[model samples]
Target: MTTGPRGFRRALNRGIPRRNRTLVALVAFTVVLTAAILVWPTVAPLTGLVVPLLLGSILLSPRQLPWFVVFLMVMLMLAIGRQQTIEVRTVIAIAILYLLCFIVLVTSFRRTRLGVAGVLGESMLVDLRDRIQQQGGIPPLPPVWLVETALRSAGGTPFAGDFVVATRPRHSNRLEIALVDVSGKGEQAGTRALLLSGAFGGLLGALPPEDFLPAANDYLLRQAWAEGFATAVHLSLDIGTGEFEVRTAGHPPAAQLTAGAGRWTVHEA
Candidate 1:
């Protein structure tokens, strides 16, 4: 009913995606072994070495896979070229060579280090999401999280006007966050989003709701050039204060949810 780390690792190994190159090499080795066994009965046992080499490659990197293939080819050539007479010295020499080449090839593939950068990037992304949750923000659910989750993107990447921040501390207060989608979608528009996010992040942290809009706009004007303009919404909610405020400019209005009613309205500042 319970599993330890080893069991969990085994499960993970079983669950590993079979579509990766490792699985590809394994399948290729199996097919090649079966063919060799059927075609050359006398050398059928030697075909077993192919599987181990392929397995090593799976535990290695794409860059080292070619060397593994080369090692196997060399061994196969040596075995095939020799006469039927079995000599102890020849067998020992071939084994030593194979072992040396395998060691060198494993060292070269470096599965342990090859994908490290990608692994680190993924870990950092998770850490960012956890930090956002700690800062009273909610992350977007899956599928969206995989591609273009505003919440995830906002947390992981630098401040961008991609998502809103909201939090409700049960013992204290409640907050409603609204995100503004800019008029365009590109690097230029994205730069403006960054500017807006910086301005909003600063103003929302300290300024009152009334001062937030003007302060954000002033900051944006100072940062963005003549060709750069942004439309945004600033939303604040105070359940204890029994008040809500939204200031916006040509953007989607926030939806207010109540026990029995739903309403849509826009607030322009």
Candidate 2:
């Protein structure tokens, strides 16, 4: 088994996720700086640096913030006790610290619009993913054929770069479906996927078959994202005649399952 400092460090590393490392580092820095000022009161003006550090509270959860705030209060009180003659600069620094802390705390409290979580918290993202699922729901297919679809991102997350939007427009026998793969690999892209899914679902049936892809391309272009490129396949099918047209933009060919041969074949766009 593992022993001592190296092993302890390894265990600690495993305890926190990569995203939270910055918070842990800042907390350590605050403690070390506080100790330094306690030993050398001449450096008390440096406490203002802590105010800027707390600005990181924007990314911190409510409960996680108290650690920094409480410790900061203790550090300030200690500095006040140690410094006999507080300089003008030191007084200004303390005032700025108090103002900044108050602002950040207020901002954190106001973020309670989600009741418990932030407005763009994980819960909100999950809700968006559910909406995307609902938007991608295939309309009631005719009895003769079975249709199945699968969408999962890398590592099997609820968030994915790939999404589908489908609809059978009112008074129309045609079913229009679009499978879009957006660029990027994380939550930001997943959120974008949900938003695009909504936009594409509306455009799919509302625009003529020939106009849909161009309209979608135009819509995406207007957004002007840096990594904005997306691949999409648009499929339009006639319920009665079984005739269909498949179009693609930077996406793979549509696949057809040959039931008799039990194999998948690619349909050229």
Candidate 3:
């Protein structure tokens, strides 16, 4: 509901998908190994090879850490067996260096990843906010102020299953607004909400008020998704006069607030 530091952290920690991370790790590990092999001849006894290998492993996802560890162990054994003249104390010291390097490199990689992800997520949110503002179809000004909000259960994304679209036709005194709830929830439903918002917003003031519901019904029937039903409330209001017409499709009745009596009344459309 609130966008702050905690929310930014949550978005960053959302992390790249496991499959993509694995692919990136594999590519990075391959490149590091290839480069090490190319330079293996110049580095005698492979005294510091394990450190670079451990650092390379930091590119890998947590699930892939074991594979990298096994590879490192195999390489270490081969290097030790080939260089029998190398001292045991030197081998032990190299192992210690490798361990320290692994710890530091992994910690640094994670922080860097979070930093990059935070920037990426903030950019994505900015883009989404701009698109929603442009395509939301909300009128600049209206006789009545309508407050709309949506809460998503899917990782606090701004998109949701419910949406509102409003428009005031040119050379007309009527204000048309539609509140729609799609069949599903979270990101999946948010997609449908986006599609329907565009379609309904375009059709809202294009036809006479009476034909709006029938056209929307035809559009939905054409979609023909299994168990894909939506509930919508369409309101057409006169700007000068306090008269309005409401149409509902499988939606709950709307409530009216009376300022004179300071009471609320529910009306079924």
Candidate 4:
């Protein structure tokens, strides 16, 4: 029988799909912003609104972005048309805005695939990287044992072809470690690294020490990616006995430093 302003707002919000709401709001704000810029075209800095709108568009659906761009293009054209004589700075500003729009639009398309928003896509990549790092971490070991791991990408970037996954399985005194180098370097191999990191991490302590590589090989074969291959080293070490088995797959041999002899011994792969 009665509805408050808040209730009306809630009802209105419920009508629009959750994904498109940001796009719609940004487009509406653009219209108002365009109006203000037009009203005081000479007084106001026209390019002031460009960055915010473009940044906001990253969170919007790619399909929704083209439409938003269309609205933006129309607003920009109308603003220029309304002016009796456009300044050189105005034309330069407009050109810069167009270039930014093109860059942002291209980025949105490349980053957001299969209907995923750019923000979500980026967050997912971050989450995957975090998981890889977490999996790479060596859990707290007893004081007697020391296990070390280090990873460096081909370049100075978060994404890389190299990663490691180590785990101490329940009901076992053995530590399982898998060192993987996916094909390519940096972003080119980052996707494959993310994928194999999880899979190799899962397979690390799951199977018997000797079965790990064959299983990993099987998993890689299933994907059937052309020129897609990875090099990995699996090491399962028994803390009690100080005995270990290092399995290699298209990877370099393991090296060990003999403390007493003060020499490095290379274990054949």
**C-alpha lDDT score of every prediction, in listed order:** 0.54, 0.78, 0.66, 0.82
Ranking by lDDT: 4, 2, 3, 1
User: Which 10 consecutive residues of model 2 have the lowest summed lDDT?
Assistant: 111-120
lDDT per residue (tens digit) for residues 28-97 in model 4: 7888878887898776566766855565666677777766776777788877776666778878888988
lDDT of 4: 0.82
Q: Judge candidate 3 against the unseen true structure and give its global Cα lDDT, from 0 to 1.
A: 0.66
Residues 72-100 of candidate 1: C-alpha lDDT, one tens digit per residue: 65556644454354468757755765675
User: Clashing residue pairs, candidate 3?
Assistant: none
TM-score of each: 0.39, 0.59, 0.54, 0.86
Among all candidates shown, the one with the greatest TM-score: 4
Best by lDDT: 4
The TM-score of candidate 2 is: 0.59
Name the 10 consecutive residues with the lowest summed lDDT in model 1. Answer: 140-149
Q: TM-score rank, highest first?
A: 4, 2, 3, 1
Candidate 1 lDDT: 0.54
lDDT of 3 by residue, 100-178 (tens): 5567446545645544333354576577655654555556556365645343345466677777777888989888887
TM-score of 4: 0.86
Which candidate, 1 or 2, would have the higher lDDT against the true structure? 2
- Model 2 clash pairs are none
